[model samples]
Target: MTKVLVLYYSSYGHIERLAHAVADGVRQSGASAVIKQVPELVPETVARKAGYKLNQNADVATVAELPDYDAIVIGTPTRFGNMAAQMKNFLDQCGGLWFEDRLVGKVGSVFTSTGSQHGGQESTLLSTHTVLLHLGMVVVGLPYSFKGQLRMDAITGGSPYGASTLADDGNGGDRQPSDNELEGARFQGRHVAQVAAALASANIGATL
Candidate 1:
């Protein structure tokens, strides 16, 4: 079966929900979805006040193992209009994969959650795509053809860049994704899965 990796980092519960929606879409498209979460960075306040550990395991898979997936979908919370440091740190270790072209021709997509509407969702998505391009992966985005586009709120989630969710950060509760945002994420997953499956089949044909 075609396998799609849904890797993400979530501090709160919002981005996690979006990851699940994306995985559901991939599964609906008849591909296997593997969800993995990056290790979190314990804040200094938490370490001092809550007695939390500052650093933890760093033994996550290296980029050489990325080829195990037919496609990859990544999710992150927008951090100053860019991917979080942990995710970037992980991607930076993919230099070997870039040099070997292991990710070439594989499908890739990005999703993000933000504290509010207009809170740099597009920027985060674009930043994530930069690493994918360097790895020679085929980038995918949501098309307006999907029915989810019509129902999204003007102020909340769903974008042509990729799937997005507007999360409430206690300043307001109204910015969270609507049902349409959830559906849009699912659509993106299925779209990438279909594209990856087609490419994998073509590769098989060439080998045969």
Candidate 2:
């Protein structure tokens, strides 16, 4: 069976919710979804510097284990118009995979959550895709043809670039994803999985 990796870093659990939705979509497309969370960072000092936190349970796998998946879906919380440092650090460690071309031709997609509607979701998604491109992965995006694009009244997650979410405030009353946002994420996941499967099949045909 084809496997798609749903890797993400969530500080407030919003992005994690999106990852789950994406996984659901992948499973609906007949692909196995492997969910992985990046390890948090630990600060050297008690002052809590720029990017540091403790990750209690981190995955202990190398890039060599990454290529086993047919596709990758990454999620992150937007940090100052970019992905969180923890996610970027994890991707940076995949240099070995980049060198070996392990990710070449594999389909890749990105998802993000932001504190506000204008909070750099697109930039965060594009930033993650930059690394995927360097690794020669085929990038995937949500198509305008998806019905959610037309029917949603207040869409906080649908983007032509990838999936996204506008997180709720500190009051704990605004974190829930709207129906449109959820539908968009599901569509994004299904679209990426279908594309990855088709590409894998095409590559197999070419090999024959």
Candidate 3:
């Protein structure tokens, strides 16, 4: 079976919810979904005080294991229009994978959450794509085929780049992903899984 890794860093609960939704979509496409998380970089005291959802239950993804996935979908909250430091730190550890070209040809995609509607959602996704491209991965993104991407009548986070969510601008953390946002996330996940499966089958046929 094609394997997909849904990896993310969620300081709060919003992106965590998005990650699971994306995983659900991956399963719908008949891919095996392995949901994992990057290790938190925050101090224990700060994490406890801020109530970070450490997600102790999810497996910690190591850079060496990245090559095992046919597809990888990553997520993070926006930090100055870029990925959070923790996610970036995790990716930084993949230098060995990059040197070996282990991630080449894998389907890579990203998602993000922001504190405000116009927050760095798209920018964050784009920035992550840059890293994926550098790793020689075949980057995938949400397309217009998902009607949710076209719905302007409602407030949501989604673009041709990747899935996103607005998590309350005032740092309230009260806002959650809207239905449209969740739909967009699922669509991206399913699309990536389907594409990865096709590529994997093609490679197998080539070998045969």
Candidate 4:
């Protein structure tokens, strides 16, 4: 079975929720999905003082294990229109894999959450895609086929770049992903899995 990894760095639970939706979408394609998180860089003492969600139970992703997957979908909260430092830190550790060309031909995709409607969701996704390209990975993205992407009547977060969510609730509520955002994540996951499976099959064919 094609193995896809849904890796993310979620300070709160917003990205975590979206990561689960993406994993669910990958499973819908009969692929094996592993959902994990980037290691926290913040000091434990400081994290507790700031009330960061340190209790997240997801397994931590290691650079050595990245080459084991056929596809990788990464999620992160936007930090100044880019991925959070924690996620970037994790990817920075994978230079060994890039040097070995271990991730070449693997499928890669990105998802992100922003604090507001125009909070650089697309920019975050694009930035992540740049790293994937540098690793020689095949990048996948959400197509216009996902009808949820075209919803302008109601506020939603999704674009051709990838799945996204608005972390801020309009009514001064806590940060969380909306239902539409989760659906967008699922669509991205399913699409990436499908593409990865095809690529895996093609690779096997070439070897035969």
The prediction achieving the highest TM-score against the true structure is: 4
Q: For candidate 3, lDDT tens digit of each residue in 1-208?
A: 9899999999988888899999999999988999899999999899989888765567889988999899999999999999999999999988999897888888999999999988899999999999999998889999889888777797788999999989995566488898889988899989999989998888942232
For candidate 2, write residues 10-71 as lDDT tens digits. 76667777888888899899988877887767444642453223342325334566788888
lDDT of 4 by residue, 96-141 (tens): 9999888888999999988889989999999999999999888899
Q: What is the lDDT of residue 163 in candidate 4?
A: 92
Q: Identify the superior model by lDDT, candidate 2 or candidate 4.
A: 4
Best candidate per lDDT, number?
4
Question: What number of clashing residue pairs does each candidate have, in the order they appear?
Answer: 0, 1, 0, 0
Clashing pairs in 2: 41-53
- The per-model lDDT (C-alpha) reads 0.80, 0.78, 0.90, 0.90
C-alpha TM-scores of all predictions: 0.85, 0.85, 0.94, 0.95
In model 1, the runs with Cα more than 4 Å from the true position are 43-62, 152-154, 169-176, 204-208
Worst 10 residues of 1 by lDDT: 51-60
Q: Which stretches of candidate 3 lie over 4 Å from their true place?
A: 169-173, 204-208
Q: What is the lDDT of residue 167 in candidate 4?
A: 76
Instruction: Write the number of the candidate with greater TM-score, choosing between 1 and 4.
Output: 4
